[model samples]
Every structure is written in C-alpha cells, then in structure tokens.
Target: MENPPGTIGPGWLIKVSSRTARPDPGACPTHLRTAVRPLVAAEPPVPFRRAPREDFAPGPLFAALDLWEQGGWSIGRVLDELRSTRGAFRGRNAPAHPSLMAWTVQAFERYVAARHEEQAAARAAGLPPTVPVRLGWTARTKKKDAPDARGGQQYEHTAWGRQYASADGSVRDLWIPSLGRAKADRAAAEKAAIAHVMANGAPTPHRRRGDTPPEDATASTRLPERVRVFDFGCADGSVTPLLDWHRTEVQNRFMADAAPAFVSAATGAGTRPGASCVDCKAISGCAALHRTPRLWGAASAAPMRGRRSVSAWDLRLHGECPAQYHLVRQLHLNDLSAENDGARRGRAVDAWLNQRHADRPVRGCRDLPIPDASSLPAAHPLEGPLAHVAVRMLTEHRVLCPLNGIGSNEQVLVQHRVTAYVPELDVVVLAVPDLLYTRRGDWIWRETKTASRPVWEGRSLLRSYPQLALAVLLFSAGALDADPRRSWVELEHLREGRGESRLERIDPSQPAVVAEAREVIADLAQPLLDDASYEPTTGRHCHGCQARTWCKPGTAYVAEHPQGVGRHPDAAEADHFADRGSIHA
Candidate 1:
C-alpha cells in the first residue's frame, strides 16, 4: 500500500518533466509539488476532472506518424487507419473535430518534409544516413540527505521527443513537435534536456525493474558529438532547428545549478487557484481557493454536459469571432506574432500595480516612487512613449489604490484567481481582478486599464468593460461572502498625465446596476453557449487574429485588408491565449 498524501514511501521517486521543471513566473508552487512529488496515494486519489475538449488532441497525430514511420504506411493510408480507430483522437469523452483530419494531414506532410530536409542536409555535409528510433533518456540520482519520510530521493529528469540516430548511434537528433509555429525552448527545460541526453547511455526498451533486458539492447554507451532540437510546426508544416549544442558546450556547463530547483519543485508549498485548479488533485485541501457558486446565472445545461470553464475573456473572444475563439482559444494554434503597443503597455501597467499591491504589510501605492522610461522596474519593461505614459499612469494610481484607507488587518489580494461554479450550467466562471481588498467587512473589486484614448462618453461602462459586468453580477450574487449593500465594483481608467485618471464606482447593491450587468454579460455569453459550429465571421479583427493562418475566412479578410485599417487599438491588448482569465483587465 502507498503512503498517504504528503508521506513518501520507499518506492516513491521525485521526478520532474521538462514542462513541469521550466520557469513559469505565474505558476503555483504547490502545483509543481503535486505534479513531480511522490506523496500521492495509490488508492482512490483526489479526483480531478477536466472539461472534455471538442478540439484536436495530438494523440492521433503522433500515432499516425508512428504508423507512417515504423509500419512503412503511406500518409493517406495512415490517416485512413486513424479515422477507422474511433475514440483514438478524441478528448476525454468528447469526439474529435472533423477539421482535425485536415490538420493532421498538414502536420504529417510537414513532418515528412522536415525529415527529408534533415537527410539532405546530412548528405550534403558528408554524414551517414540516419533512421528514426524510439529513444528516451531518464537521468536519475539518489540524494544523500532526504527531506521527507523517504530515506533518500530519486531525482529523475526525463527527455520526451522524437529521436533519430545514425547507424552506429554516433549522431542523434531530437525532434519536438508543436501544433503551431515552432518557438524557442525555455532555458531551464533546454538545460534539463541536455543533462538527460549527456547522462544516459544508448536507448533500450522500457520494462519493469525485475524484467529481463532485451538481447538487442546496446551496451556501447557513447555520447553523441552533436545534439540538436528540430522543432516541427504542425500548423504550417515547417521545421526549424531550435537548438544545436556541441558536446564540448554541453560538457562545459555545471550540472549542479539544476539540482536545487529540482528539489524545490518537489518540496514547494502554497496554492494558486487558476487554470491549474481545474486539473488539481489537491484542490479539496487548498485554503487559498475561494469558491463562489451560481455566479454567472447560467441556466441548467442538459444532462450529460461535460464540465467547462468560462471567463470574461472567453465571452469577449467569442463575441469578436467564434472561429477565432475555437481556433485560437480551444485549438491553441498561433502564428507567434508580436503583440501590439497598447496591449503591451496595459500589461506593463498591470504588472507594476500587481507588484506594488502584493508588497508586505499591506500598503498602498500612495508613497511609492514614480518610474521613468529608464528607471522602470526590470520585471515590467516598457519602451518609447508608452514607457513615459506608463510612468504617468503609475503616478495617477496613487490616489486610487484600494489599500489606501483600509485597516491593517483587512485582506488584500492582487491578481488573485477568483473562481465560481454554476451548478446549473456545469461551468466554472473565473475572474482575476486588478485588486481585491476589504474595507471594514465589504469587498472592493478594482479593475485598472491603460488606454491611449479615454473611454468613449457614448458607450455604457458595463459594455465598455465586460469584466466589470461579471464582477457586478458575482458580488451581487454574494460570491465574495459579504453584504452586497456595502460591496461595490470599481473601474480605474489611467491615461497619460497626472489627475487625468478616472475612477468609476458601481454599486452592485442597486437593482438597476445588477440588471444592466446581467444583460451585458448575457448578451455576450448567450451566443457563445449556443454556438456549436463556431463558423468564421470576417472583420478587421481577423488581421490581428493569431490563428488566422489556419482560418480561411480570416485569411481572406486579412488579405483583402493588408493595411490593417479597422483593427481596434485596444483589441491588440486582449489576451487570446490565456488558459484562464488574464490580469490584462
């Protein structure tokens, strides 16, 4: 029997994947502990249920790749075989989208082209032909002085990617696949891969500890002279060599730098409930998580509706274009384009405020030093005119800080994930306010936004910022465990210069405000809930759409309007790729 949660047995191992080991400035440390640590029980463990996806799952794509490479089947034949295998490409209990077939074909062709290019380049360089191989590296070490119940720790770094080697196994290549454009690997993850590649010997078939080793297992453990990461793009079927390291370069690096981080990931504590909460097994005992029920006022979904998460951003994206929502948000296909200036400035301002709000002793921004273009904090780097504008905005925020008059004992949460579940809708509604602090006993939800221009006088505030509408609804529904009469929502609009920022407060206690908030949210959300096809609608927003490369209508729209005339300056700041609600508000 395995030990209970937080107690490691003798068989327990502290293993970390490249994905889990990489630096995520926003990641919850407790999440890392739950993922890599070995204290989980074998019996009915903490149940974590994820929403069923209607988008493409990569299992079938890779499986098809295997059939094409190992079984010597043609691409068409592999896809046909894949289609015949029902439930193979699906997610959870949901069926795969029909568009995935086209995506798979494009991805497979790209893979083949990448391989051909690799072989050609090798031949040109007078290198021998290489063949694909099933190779994995697991670098394990036993720590002398362990922390928990276990006497020692087995620290493991596993390499996950497609592998290829020369006939003599002297040269090897690791191909990493991405559904969209290939991007650079995280520094820590790249280093971990190097450590794994250098520490392990020749590849062998995986088996149980007591199982006999295969006769063909190579004993000649020779380190390759060269290691390269070939990043394959499934969206456009392009392959880019992301990283190439010589053996000397790998040997020169210190292996000890990664050790402390590995141990810390296993032993780290604290909870941050956001996107990770949806799949967290330790959520039951997490005190940091604040749950609010029936916050969205969504009607009861039909029987057998798979649980899903909803956020203000989701409704915003769906309203912009449903196809963009499905392709960018659900499918997660991006062209790796740079964000526009307004969005970047807003993000910088958000970060700066969050940092100030998160300071110890629960102080306000009233006394903080204003930053200039050169003196801005290293974490929130802005440039050119926007940097100056951000500085002025930061100055304006001093008076509007929620902690200014609040009692010392009052709670202050900045950029904290606020989650609520609508039982009727089978949906989890998420919101992350710029600042959430308490005065007396009432909760104050503040949303800060930076804009080149001021809020249009004609538009309703609720329609201008839908998040406030959601906030009003949540607080009015008693989501924060406080009296609605005392609690209210705030929108702080910061523009360049002193005394120009406007702070608008909405009383959620008022029936008129509550009704308007409901209508604002429902008008945007109802169409999304009813959407089944997610058809593309052509507009100027398509020009800035990240997934437009794969969307025909969006592509056509962008092509016709190459000048990018009608794209909203603020829309560029919207976060289309955030797994949960972003601090972009």
Candidate 2:
C-alpha cells in the first residue's frame, strides 16, 4: 500500500530534514560558519565555562554566599534568580552556567555553617556574645558580703589584696608575697634624708628682729644717738666714698661719737632727739630710714662748737633717667622742648646740623633774643593762660628766656637758658641730649645717635643722665652729705655718632639755681621716705624705667589681688602646705 502524503519513511527522514531545515540562530556563530556541519536532531546544549578558581578567592565567595543564605534564599533559588536577572551565558566566549551556580551555593552553605561554629566557640570561651564589656570600675562592683561557715568566701580589695574565710567562718588576710614593706620603707627613708638636709641648710635672713639677731651687735644700741645715711641707686659708688669722708670730717670737726642731728633732718627724720637711731653702716641706716622713719628724726642737726650744722643724708636715684639731675641741678628739664612742636622741630633741625657737620665742632649758644612783646598775639583761652603763668613764673624767678632762630643750612637754632658748672674729670655721662661746652662758656646741646631714624627729624643727643640728676639733687640737698662726690651718673650710648664723647660735671649748682632746685628737692623728699602716693608719673618717661614691670599700677594691682579670682580648695591646701614646709628647709 502507498504511504499518506504527509508521512515520510524513517530512512529518508534524517536526510530530508537535514536538507530542508534552516540553521539555528542560537547556535555558536563560529561553529555554524565552519565547513563541517553536525548531523544532529537539535543543537547540543552549549557547554558553560567555569571561571578560574584563582580569579574569585574562596574567602570572598564564601562571604557572599553566607550573606545570601542568611537572607532566607536557598542555593537553587538564588542561582535561578541570578540566571533570570542576568543571562545564563554571561562570558564573552561561553556561558558560566550550572557549574558556577553549584560552586557558589556550596560555598555559601559552608560559610554559614563555619560562622555559626565560630560563634559557638566564642561563647564557650566565656567571651561576650557580640558586644565587648568595658574595662574599669564599671566591670566590677565592691563586695561587702562576709564569709559564711559552709566552705569559705573570698573577697578582693581594690589594691588587689585578698581575704579568705577561716575554718571558724572568720575572714583572714591572704598575704601576697610580692607586696613587701621594704619599698615603702625605702621611700620614707629617702624623703626623711631630703628633709633633714633641707632643715640644716642655710636659713634666709629673717625679717623679724626677734627671730634672728641682727648681724651688727650695735644695731639697737646705736639708735638715734648716731646719724645714718643711705645712698640709694649709688652708681659706681661715686658719691658713697665722698659721703664717708665727709662723715669722718664732721665727726672729727665736732669730736662727737654720734652722727649730727642735721644729718638726720636731711634724711626726712624729725628733729626730735630720741626719734631715730643711726646704724654705723651706710646701707643699714638707709634701709632703716626706708623701713622706719618715725624712729628717725625729721631734721638732723650737727652741733659744731655748740651751733647746729645743717646736714642731710639719704640720697636716692630711681627711675629710668637717673641723669635728670644734670639738667635740673643747673637748668630744669622743662617740658619746653618737651611740649612745644616748635621746640621739637628745632631739635630736628639741630639733628640735621649734627649729621651735616659731624666733623665740625658746633657750640651751643646761650642768651638769644626773645620774641617781641608786640609780635605775640593776645592770650587765647588755654595756651595763653598757661604761657602767661609760665612766663610770670620765669620772670618772678628772674630767669632769662630765649628766642628762636634759623641757623646755616636752614637749621633752627634756639638758645637754652641754664646755670653753668665746671665739668668734672672722670665724670660718667648718664643721659643723651646732653650739653657740650665751647671755649667761650657757650653751651651746645646734642642728642644720642640711634640706629633707627630719629623720632624727631634731627639728630638727637642724650640730654642728662637721670641717675646723675638724682645724684646731684641728692648731694646738693645734702642727702649724701656722708657720701658726697663719691658717686655720679653713668651714661652709655650703644654706638658712636655726632658728639659721641661722654661728659661729666660736678653737681655744683649756682646759688640761684640751687635755690630753685631746693623746692624740687623738697617735693621729691617724701617719696624717699616711703610715701605710697609717690608713684613715678606714667608717660614716655616710664619707657626706660628699670622698675616699670613691677611698678606699673595695673600689674601691681593684679599682683596684690591674685586671690580675688576663685581658687580651688585643693590648690589652696597645696599652697598652704608648701608655704608651711618652705621655711623648714
């Protein structure tokens, strides 16, 4: 019988199908294009390539698997999902299929099981389950319970000492052999040795007389019966020796065993006979007066031939400008050049003269003309009255005033009125802006040269040594009668410039000058006697003061009130302990 039209014989089926069917698009392109064709019913499933084991390490792969397993996904479920989301054949050449999925699932299961084992091991070791316990007081509490009779209870002290219950239920100390008393004994011995050395060390001079006897046996015995002089700020001890000689001379002249009463008076002591006593030593006497002037007489009188000789002791030089006495003893260091812009301008002009004619000697001229009375304008409110008062004061004192003038090279020249004195040999120059003398008794004013440009335009000279001025004032007022001419001011200029020579002059003031100088001397007298109100005026003048740091009002006030700020109780106790123990050494 003939077969149906739709049916084909089995023998012909393979050849006919192979000849009629189209190539599968899903087949590898390279294999499909090759000359040889496979005689198969369907394309063989493409083999997946496994990644090199070295490429993905076991650790990271295992971790990733553990994460997936912990999230409630089974190995097969995760693999299927991954395959659906990302094509099965993801590699360039071939699919990384079932093999990769199986390996990943196995790794995940192993990682999860390993992690659980690790947690169990940690718990077995008595470690915290997850979080760590903090160390310190929080980790433990102090036990107050006592041991019972059953067995024995053990307790630990903060110092790590142990206590154990005895057979009778009483607690007994469990000695730790390592903790010996030797260490504490050694430390105590060292401390004791240090303390003993300190106690036997030299003691500081006690301020209280009763605590320590005076070095000088006659300190109390030589009370007001002797006159004592103190020369403070005695630079180079120039005036000290002279005062000593003078004291000897007075003693010889009077043939007296004690200092003259006049000497006590000059020292700011009352004239009362029994008010004060003088120490034979100059420094001691001065210190005594500074400390206790009430015991010293206001006025010290020298009895020579039954007549009291005028004498004074106690010379002091303080402040930055000790050379001030050089000017004030002869001429006042007025605010004239200090205050007037014109005067300052003139000084600048003088500075230029100094630089231009450094080699040429310039003489300072005195007695210049004054401004015409008519040229002066009518008095203004502030300046006029001040000028009038100054002029009146000057006129009353019969002092001559000078006029301003312009010198060669457009330099302003003005004469300064002053009392003249003979310059002394071996004199110490103590200030800048000093005066130089010419053959004709004319005075030339000069200033010290500084590396920096002058604050005023002209070259400036050190005028007067403030220390010297103080010395002179004190000496002339008989403050250093016991140590006269033994001291003077010392002026030091950093570098040499115009008029660089150092000069010195005796503190001899003219009669009229001395008269006016006495008034100033009196004004400053109280300060030497320890008047608290006697503060040095603040200004540029304070810039060079030696005691500026300690004497400054603000600093002094703060130093006096340190306790005003709250202090910790512990700190206070420490300080108290330190203070008490300090003297023991």
List candidate 2 stretches off by more than 4 Å.
1-464, 473-495, 500-509, 528-530, 533-585
Who wins the lDDT comparison? 1
lDDT string for model 2 (205-284, tens) is 32331232234422322111111111111111111100112222333432232112111111222111111111011112
Q: After superposition, how far is residue 540 of candidate 1 from its true place, in Å?
A: 3.8
* Candidate 1: 10-residue stretch with minimal lDDT: 576-585
lDDT score for residue 402 of model 1:
75
Residue clash pairs of candidate 1 = 343-573
* TM-score (C-alpha, index-matched) for candidate 1: 0.73
Best model number under TM-score: 1
- Residue lDDT tens for model 1, 391-446: 88888888777787668889898876676545345345678887888888678888
Question: Each candidate's lDDT (Cα)?
Answer: 0.66, 0.24
In angstroms, the error of model 1 at 566 is 6.2
